[model samples]
Target chain A: MNSEIRRLTTTERRQEHCDVLVIGGGTAGSMAALTAAQNGADVLLVDKAHVRHSGALAMGMDGVNNAVIPGKATPEEYVREITIANDGIVDQRTLMQTARRGFGMIQRLESYGVKFERDEHDEYAVRQVHRRGSYVLPMPEGRDVKKVLYRALRLAKVRSTNRVMVVRLLKDGNRAAGVVGFDSRSGNLVTISAKAVILATGAAGRLGLPASGYLYGTYENPTNSGDGHSLAYHAGAELTGLECFQINPLIKDYNGPACAYVAGPFGAYTVNSEGNRFVDCDYWSGQMMAEVAEEVASGRGPVYLRLSHLPSDTISTIEGILHTTERPTRGTFHANRGHDYRTRDVEMHISEIGFCSGHSSSGVWVNEKAATTVPGLYAAGDLACVPHNYMIGAFVYGELAALSAIEHGRSSSIVDPDESQVEAAIDAIYPPLSNPDGLPQPQVEYKLRRFVNDYVAPPKSATKMEIALEHFERTKTEIARLGARSPHELMRCAEVSVIRDCAEMATRASLFRTESRWGLYHQRSDFPDRDNARWFCHSILRKDSAGAMEMSTRPVAPYVVPVEGFEFPTTAAGDGEPDAA
Target chain B: MPSVLSRTEVPVSIDADLCVTGCRLCVDMCPLDSLAIDPETSKAYMYVDECWYCGPCAARCPVGAVSVNMPLLLR
Candidate 1:
């Protein structure tokens, strides 16, 4: 039977051994691998795409969204801001790790030739994007961030294996032994044995279908197909606040951020069709998004990012930064549409919902040290649930996870690869290749994400969520019937299964929370009120021993910095702003 | 259903005249893994309709052979 399973797909097999294995080569995975290798651990960083361009930072970032710089902002103050922004459901200890160490991480990146904007005084040019504090630090020359990280990874001698989509973590009695995956180009089975594994595969960005009707058009890099979320859940790691989805205001059809954080300080704000500012702040809080959603659904339906009010020179400056970094196609997107920042307000709409800890509190639950609930398994980056931890936070937690993983690797010996688990993983990955005449991957994935957008996008109701669960249940069989014409398509087919799993997890967590919280993020239409006494705790989702998804709650940890006198504004402030939909 | 040849302009295009036949930089830089080397032409081309139009293919091109146009839908 084992031989038959091995022969199911006639592809090459390869094995590797490392002291620490990082399963992504993006922003956090790059840092984690560099840190581990610099600390003298044998590290192997794996990515589904080339390490030079992978994950959210594939095109490099535009700015540091949460930089806790010295003299400008204290870690405690930053923590309070995020706690309020995330609606007070955060582990301060975990957030403090990012807040306290993010500055050092930024300096570390600077050491790698990455640049950050500084004023004439040479102090970091931090801008105000949050409701209370200034945390946004611009990176005008950030387009080469990935190139710099890639160069740093090479210098550190971290062995990077690109184009391998790691599907499962090999477990030895709750300790992560290694990972099993297949090559995206060649369909080769890859098993890496390691003392510890760090999961940095980013957000479940591909869960919801984009309004453009394009399967690959996603807010985060489409490569981040909920692989980490599904892998973590399957490995019994608790995922926190899956109900707290990441919904941003983005360029309609384009599906990328209107990037108010970059332009907000430059005087760009979201406005209704009547050219009135409905929301006070452009910072991406659930409350702000709730306001945006409200105005869009109301008589003031279509909103625009009001950039026309800014001076042409100022718009040019904003364009110089925006068009060059992150999604550089923003310039082309505008140019092709005959829209100019000087003449027209860029049309804006609510983005398709996704599970991301970089923006919201939805990810594999990790402690301050970046260790998951399961030992020997660590998580960082957007997938690690350090609430609202952006790029700098990813670097901070990556460093923390690397340090902890190195220590853990030293104390533990490599466990033998679990044969049964490897066989099962191979069996799961090769089905699509064998059934080449089965349903195409794109069609199956499109339907699954469409279900995500239809039944689970937001303004959640119990009945809608139940129906979503039913569709997801049926999609499981559909996933089994998926076909792939090549190894590349096989990788996408495997990703569809991952997306389906995430959709179900999101639905289950939304149902379990039972009360409306986090503004539009987990807003329950049936239960429209915030029930702090009953639902203020963190909702955790994990796979049970019986292989069924289970949910439970963990009390919000005692605050390190006490927040007082701040009224919990459950709904959007009324200024003709509609309720959270 | 029978397949029919459909014509549509893709977001990414390679100037094969300028492209180095052996270099796969643009193909490897695509996050969606959309670009691939054509065996017949020995030049990189967009193999799938799954482009994010993110421009890494063009950005990473050493010879400036790659151009990522805005997809028609967005255009």
Candidate 2:
């Protein structure tokens, strides 16, 4: 037993203790930390990057949609919108809870000096607003939200360690005790003991070529490495909704800027590859891509825009309508708007329509109060599965996670730290740091990315997924042999571990359902129908004692909404004509 | 007729703050000898009449603070 044990006495090791340890300092993590600290708990926020630019902070247009609008909007209306958007797959109870809490979160954020944009009418003039309950708040430009949140955390005296990637949660029996991670700057192992752990890490982008295009270049922040989901699963937390992945149709190739084309104010037509217009102009009235997806799936076309030649003023007006910064120059706009022609060269065009799960919906399942099955553990942001539609819902979920964590921390009694849990965490990571093997880190990442992108991408088939699963099992074995040259490299290894774990969960969930539902990126051709009877419940994945991935199913909680006198316009339409200029 | 000699001319100038020492290679390379090194600042100062915004000075400035803006009418 003594001979089998390998420990590094020479390497630097540091330990810290806190009431709450929040991982991944993106929107959700930062907000959770801020909320927890403000409620008078000592919190430590950890992130993989030195900067806190996660997906929501980097790519979000700064729109916060909450059910706070006056007049006709109510929490019920917001819940209905989500259920309608999700095709009745969303958990209405969770959706309503999030909607009810959304406005208060925004108001709290405003109190922190995070200014939202307002209209000339002196009311918030955000793009998406529901009459009774749903309203959108604008985010400031170029990562200001992250900076503001960081400042707020600093003011609240919340401690943070950036550039440290959390590899896994340290568990004492079924309860979370702390987390084990590596410092990117020094390549040192740092462990933190905490009373409660909140996984606020943002969404996972399946490992692949960075999504780039003619109009936008490497737009999505590369940091969404899926560490939170992987850690939670490894720590024996139940994960749900891995099958539902949202894809944004408007992403441009070549890493150009993302134009707000989808947010076009009503009546816009999406054109296909043959330069022909498709999609029912009225269906999913606000979000045109839902109809666009149907058109593409039916083989009607790969869409593009077609419009009559426009004068200079008309071109500018169209650019304004599309919320594009640059005017539609003959060369730039034509190339930017034309995705159908570009997607043919998969290698050249980095941007593909609906390539990713649109939102970070698949994660550790938590109660309505954001508590996981595991005691002393909580999740928020894209990391926690709180049933709602994609991006719009994630913002509200982040706030809910933070608020729920505050409540959980306050009501719960403090327990002494478990030495065995700390020892176990230390033992698990010490091997990688001490291993002398010189392994290339990027190769591991490339292998993981290829495995997910090639095998698990949308429009999946059972045979293809099975083949991919075989490769994934092989890759999991290969990952153990991977060597890290430095601390940052060690974090990369941890990231690979997280991604592999997430892929395993995603694959198992995709396979278990045997049916295609919303965001069917991993669709199996064998069972094409939406099997509501057999697979209505959520697929849950957990890790066993031997560190093996396990899978199961759990029933989704039911909730009913009062949907009466919901006045939706029937003939209301905007100009559907594409600008030809 | 007894000819009066016709000469083609250009103009050039530079800012000291935009220039640094151990540079000014552009002053020696100008074919028309329109540039001169300011000994105090070790930057290239140009004679406007003989200088032109030909981009050689801006390209050669290692610090990249030098710029040449030409009028649209001149082009």
Candidate 3:
């Protein structure tokens, strides 16, 4: 109940310099900052919240989704599976980097006190969640992930500024020079100059409104409102697979992961209202989601995770792991509704659409070295276009980005940011503050996201997407009228702008790839078919010099691992048999 | 135009008797920046209803006085 609103007349300005600048303190940014600092580089890590607990892994993850073990799976096998999973719209070299370097990254993470599930024989207890490979490794007690990363950062002597929301990147002749943002705790403008910059801000989770009509309730952390996507696009970086939205099967009203990945290894599977299994694979891919969506739309209107038949001990074990890990409030949420996994079926629903290259293939494009098209600028984790990167992929690519940044810092000199660009960033950020009596930030964001759900969510058509683009254009003016009562409100206002940018990107990308591909994701009502001859390659988009989003295509690079006449499977279900742990 | 003030129960609650006067563990760790120290009592309370209910506030509490419930809508 903060009723008082203050109109500030002037704001303080601060400046700093560093060898490497890491934008986010999430899974990838933390590793990037840690690795860069450990390699004897002066690093500055900035976050909108405290680095100790922020981003997607703020409460820690239940398991690593794409772990590649030496004996269990080889790099080439992993690459082929990901290529097929992403429907051959992948940069095989980038996936190979994570496939080859992930085990070492896992060992490095273990050195930093992160625990992994290993068997009595001291082998990684990897489970099969993919169609062809076994990669899902559970971290049953992995709740202190951020705390451990924060401690490692402290030991490395890396400088960090918490509660600062970065909104733009500073470029020195097509190379990333630094970043510009403002402190959320105090309304001071912050400008930091660096020789190399890495963008690790998490996915655009807040693009579509949740079914519960709640703004903060999103599958990804609500704090990650597509800031990195917007920042990279504004910096003139090429983004790929934006049409491949991140839509998962989550709990209905709670909007959390229904968590088949965790329960699947424990013998739980998704079934239709008739108590019959619909999809054979519980692995999260666009094809799996399409099958689930079809089942929900058919005679079997609602889907439920059938755990009622499992033994009592098995139920308790699944509950223990699910309750303590990511989205721990899930237990209380189910209890409040008088639903128990032992008796009643846990309800499942499709999640709101989002832009996550970690789960799908939509993000700022990066190479095997984790470098973006812009020099001195790098990206990794959920925001980078390494399809289905998951947590371990984020870790592996974070290390790669850090190694590249360290090498870049050794060769490059700090370039001075133009004062005019810094002033423009300041000018864009403070408009909401001056309009203290105008529209509230939350209302503006809610309406924009609602439009995303109406016009840009699945079953996309060119007509509806063009309408969405029109609404997003008008939303730009609506965002300008947002009012901020405090620095916290100002931060929310900035996120509204970022979310708007992501919505526009999603629409434009969906409209550009005039075909039904990636299953439920980017399924155009008009196109209705996947045209491999034309729309087979990666759909890339970026902000052109004219300040407009321009679309183009790049032929999928010569496949490092041969995939012969690959046509993405419309449905991955087979025999309806669940995989055992 | 006058700003309207409405009351709603927030997720994160701190017991004033058990909360340390100068401690800000919960306030500092909130990802959404929802919690703040009440100037009148020097006790931390959720100032906004925008809580993600991710439980960092409850986990980071030094005195074990903070508890986070699901936001009302989700609950």
Candidate 4:
């Protein structure tokens, strides 16, 4: 099937070739591009927005949550902690890579001018955020992380293109041949052929509607409309753990991160509405989330972070970090509502549900080397399946993907696909431009996400998910009729399809598991209990060879370090192969 | 059905005088693709209220033309 000697022709299209193509310019995308270029590969890094400030780190992070710095934490300790945090549903091999390589990734960032908080000894002032380990390294100056990464991208000589929104991949049989996309600025179709493609687009963060009724305001950057997640799924890659939704405790209405990790260092922890510490620890886990969900839904309604008791100086320090990085608009959001951390407590609520591995494990499945099941296509960062792999994990895996892609690009004999295949994608993007009077992408997106909140957002019931599948099924047709008036809206229209696919996967994975796990994330109201007998395996969703959504259970690979106190499915002990559920 | 002309309280404010023609850095940098240059005036403006208030448009503008405010829903 490597027969591609035909002359390619196209209209209103730009064609380019690179040894490796990194399809996003966010944290992982930039790092992957930098590594590929440093290894002396001709790389193309294209993003829907500018590389300088895009993806989840558009304004940079509040801190590195998974920094396994020496003298602070060991890789084994981190693996064990994450194994426990994920409720024992982790592929330790992939997470072990992130844990082991994260320190180097942090130093690389530091060398490029991204600073991390240090103690008097200038040792990485790692603090305890997880229940069992100290891995949260605060970067009070973390928003500049994007600037440092952008500089690294420039120094490494990666050719960067901003404002290009990729819609789909051009597959040459099983391997990814190239991409089919358009420029966001002028709405022109641009195609790129490459030996290897790495999708570093962040999570499907916009899957659920925010309670505030504002669609753009979300916990993760709204730009991460699950473009990479859906792109991989449609390209026939197995997506894992989507049932484990990325639910965060956030400041209500504003829908920004409450930033418990940032606030915890300064004596702020989550409390019930009556201002009592309901949970023993502030580290985010399914158990912690379950506590918050139960407490919030209880007579102790509207759980919050009680920071009013902190001294004024301490409160100001917390405010400084909270206001300037990782959803920096929290200051303005609180001010307009007449709330103060020194006086009134910050109201906290569970955020909109999403499919992300950054907070929880749910993404396109990749191995320890960051290779997806599809040949020549790799994934990194939150969109890849490395459980609870925070910022450092994203960077490490990004480098891994770039290194692996460079190696693959050297050996792969793939070439450009036929022009008709490229033209078909180009031809598809134009229909919305032609159908100016069709449904607005926003209206369709809003409705789809609302359906997610209603049926798929957990404390899930079988009936609700079944109804959700019905709505998602109808959304598949409604998304086709989505119209756009501008290139920007066209980008959104294209993203709507990705969001729809993620919604379907989320629903299917949620339904197939049939057991309540991850607190309110995948808690089936009807099931009400963890069924370790049959549902302990990772929920893997894939589009079958016949182009139908199929859900199966992938055996959670046996841990390198023996895990205690948690029960594994009986099937995992005897059978290593996945059981079709 | 007919569409009604509507306007929103845009969170991002760009100085038309400082927004030099061909300087669409803010327009290009907006992650949501919320900001676009007015073709006739050649100055970038927030065409939609979909701004997440992540503030990259203001950060990357070479001419310091973009000023961002938190949207009213949150602000």
Candidate 5:
């Protein structure tokens, strides 16, 4: 493979057929591609960036938690932890199955040569603890994890194409057979036909912020413009949990690039404008400074996170306790110690860093088998919402999704779509390429971002959401006028189309559920309180006749008792047992 | 490929008041050994060719004065 291949420049229509086509080469996508290939399926992994820098890769290798200790933890115990953390909104069956298979997944990761921290006793260290069932762990930075996973994908010989944007799913009746997308560099339409399609295309955070809307460069990896969610929805897959959105609170406030002094080494506390400590002081003890924004958001302060100095030994003690190998030196720490720089100085400064638990929680709803309502199409990772009370539940569910998809692919026969279905999807994009007077790509994206952020973001009230829906309805009319000058521009237009579809669905779901629950920030003043008896059901959104959004409710899967006790050690932290680090 | 532009233009400056007390924290943290105090200015100056834009020096400037701009786009 020549690394120096010149960037593609012309529109070349090419097609590749495979047994499994996995969109988005992030953590879950990498795992899915490898698993399918290992199971004797030809796999095609596509990503928006030239590199495999999806959300998971960018965030570093995450804390993989499982109950592996003898006598201290069980699958049931793990399930209880997730349910409690979710505040009764999690799907119990999916939670248990993910917990039960958590160890096997870690073993798979270890087989790929990804090294985890170990104790001085030469045993795998367990660093995670459960607080009221919310499993939390220390995540090493992003680069280390990406290197290990890239190696694993290479070892499996999975074929991948970078800078390819999947615009829509090619469907056969109700099942998904393939996807149609464009190569970003060369303005050409390309299609990948497959027997099964797994959407690992991560979250929709970028859809909310305008400046960083490009798939990899923006607030998110810019590439994650909710194409997978939109593709699945348009293919008639039932989308759930679109209402929950995560807001990352620990972002750097403007005060001249966050001094490594305040955030990195000094262990400074975040205070709001009025200078009050807002976050739960005792919780997040190790990263006590990290939760400053979240504490303020829940109405702890008039503004959000502000920094305060801590004792000199506080930083060193935390580093020593976490056994950090790379620690900041004293001289480096001293330079960043000034308080004169305030929030008004930087571009997109983060006054506080608070992330909505929703980003990890909401997604396409899947069953215990990791199968979406639409057959042959599966979702995993942050894209699929498998109810888990704890944060570490995502790693567990990612493994479960891989296993379920592998099983589904193996047992079921592959069905290729007829020519007409592919033609329909091709026709949707052909007009933009053919027409002389089409609206530019940037204009379409600007309109799409404004509509979603205004309607779908936190502080989502019924009136505001209704107004957002009206804006989306009007924007759909404007889509016909949008044009693309190049392949990349065409893909952006298609991406905005998908975002419009998702935003409309999210609005309908938000409107249907009147009461405030987990992730639905207290925007709706009237419908406050977690009404378990009345609003406990999962809000399922689907497209109805005439292609309008429709909403319905369904009961959450009940928790089942395990046949035998799987012994796992419980940490002093009390939520559940940690995985063999 | 031959370098697109033959010579790279480099920018340099010094703040004498930044080192009034003669502290050497900036020199100690420079991973590339690029900075040295000039006797004339009594302040740190980059050796130009040896500098790496790791940004540690700028981040560690005690009075929050040091600033460096490296134009290599990693992309």
Candidate 6:
């Protein structure tokens, strides 16, 4: 962790060069850097925080959500399940890449001393939590995931820097030429000129205001801030599936995941106040979210994950696993309220809306090679458009992006860094530092996110979204006035801009679809029906030449292995009775 | 614009005795940079209210110099 933090210059600013630059060193960026380095490209992996402990996988994950081990589950089955889970909005090629290469990634991580649960015969312990295939591979000791990746990065000789928060990409014509950002600790400016760039900056988790009213309280790591999503949009890269919001069933106020995946296989499940299951599956899909939201909104006002039914020993196991990985502080949050699994029910509420393809499909669009619409630019992990491609999928897509960049850079010459563009980027990052009495970032962000909640948080409406767009446009002006007394505050100010971009993208994409899909994720109250014949295409958004967001659609590529009888939870009870509309 | 320091106790705490003089392991690894080295004491301290309580500071502290409590608001 200490070794990952280094400074290149003593003065105010510095410049560096690399064949490939991987931004945001988390689960995916680490792999991208390693793959690029192993492929003989000089790579620079820069992160806003320490690479050893940053992004969604910073504290490490509890399990691999989509692991396709050879005998446990085949690639075909894995792809089909994800396609169905996402309601067929996915591009099969990239998802197939994740399914096929998932085992290799697991083996690679295992070689690095990262352990996954194994059966008595030494096979991967894959659990069934999704609608179809058995994919969840538990990692009880997975807190060491980042440590393993850090060691791998060092072994592969990937050059790196930390605490430098990249604000935007330096464009060479329409292609990404480099990156520019400021150090979050010292405010020292940074510029990295590269032949190609890979964005693993993670989800737009902070786009929606949490019910808790705390700005940092979000389902994803707070540092994500939609950096990749904003960067890609501004660089003119087309982003797809923005309408498919990532809404999870979380602990009411704390807002962390209720973690049905870890508890479901152990016999605990999500239930309304009546202590009856509403949805047939525990998979965190928009359909499941819709059902839960419906039940909670009705007379079954509150929800709880019923864990008291389990045996004492089984409860102990659940407690041990839930308390240690990912959101490790959940135990304390529970104990503070005197809620124990043995006697009391842990309260459940749906998570605030955000963009995350690792859970649902809303992110920067990319192909099977992990390349975005813009050449020399790539995306992976939750920010990439591979639906339901969780942790292992992040690693695979990272490898795909790195290899793609290496191949592309080896053939093409590095774009000459534009001096004016570099100056403009540096100029954009310093306004907060220059002001002494401007509006504080948190207030600005809080107001911005409140608009997101009112306008975009599910059960959507055309009139309300139009109103959301108006508020977002006004917030963009407020973001310019955002000031900071410290580098940390400046990071928030920069993040506000990113959040604004995501909010606009989400609203426009939601309105463009004109019909509800993915259940609560894109539930348009006005357009209350799924129009597969007309609205089946992926909703795409990007910044046009005139600097306005343009919304369009891209056809979902033909399924490689034909999909049939796929289902997302509908507006019906588990007993197949027609639920209240 | 003028600014006033708002007071709030951060959840993460660093044990001064266990921390080494030139070491900023916990400080560097904090995603929020909420943990910092006190220049005079040369020991890490929770300097800001931005901590997410993600626990990397405590987890990566080689000598186990850091510990985190749930934030005041959440608790």
Top candidate when judged by lDDT against the true structure = 3
Instruction: List candidate 2 segments past 4 Å from native.
Output: A1-11, A51-55, A65-68, A126-143, A208-220, A254-263, A266-269, A274-276, A281-301, A305-360, A388-396, A410-437, A545-547, A562-581, B1-75
Query: Between 2 and 5, whose DockQ is larger?
Result: 5
- CAPRI-style grade of the A/B interface in model 3: medium
Among all windows of 10 consecutive residues in model 5 chain A, the one with the lowest summed lDDT is A1-10
RMSD of 6: 6.1
Candidate 4 residue lDDT tens string, A1-581 = 01111111234567888999998898899999999998899999998878888888888888888889888788998999988888888888888998889988888888899999889987999989888889988897988888888887887778998888887787877888788888876766688899999999998988998887678888888888898887787788888999999988888777676768888878888888777889887877777888888898999988888889999999999999998888767787787678889898888888898988988999998889999888899999999989899788888989999999998887785577567776666555666666678788878889999999999998888899899989988987887777677777778888788788888889888889888887777888889988877876888788898988898886778887677866565666533333322
Model 3 C-alpha lDDT per residue in residues B1-75, reported as the tens digit of each score: 466866777777889899999999999999999989999999999888887778889877988898777777777
Worst 10 residues of 4 chain A by lDDT: A1-10
Each prediction's TM-score versus the true structure: 0.95, 0.73, 0.95, 0.95, 0.71, 0.94
Q: What proportion of true contacts does candidate 4 retain?
A: 0.75
Q: List the residue pairs that clash in candidate 3.
A: none
Could you report the DockQ of all the candidates, in the order they appear? 0.70, 0.02, 0.76, 0.68, 0.03, 0.67
Per-residue CA lDDT of model 1 for A157-249, tens digit only, reads 789898999988999877999999988887788989999999999999998988887787788888899999999999988888999999998
Count of residue pairs whose backbone atoms collide, per candidate: 0, 40, 0, 0, 32, 3
Ranking by DockQ: 3, 1, 4, 6, 5, 2
Candidate 3: list runs displaced more than 4 Å.
A1-11, A567-581, B1-3
User: What would the per-residue lDDT of candidate 5 be over residues A418-445, giving only the tens digit for each residue?
Assistant: 6565566665654565543677655566
User: Comparing candidate 4 with candidate 6, which one achieves the higher TM-score?
Assistant: 4
lDDT of model 5 at position A391: 25
Q: What is the TM-score of chain B alone in each candidate?
A: 0.89, 0.58, 0.90, 0.88, 0.65, 0.87
Q: Is the docking of candidate 2 incorrect, acceptable, medium or high quality?
A: incorrect
Among these predictions, the greatest DockQ belongs to 3
Superposition error at A264 for model 4 (Å): 1.5
Per-residue CA lDDT of candidate 6, range A46-159, in tens?
A: 998899898898788898888898988889988888888888887888899998998999888889899999989988889998888788899989888898899989988888
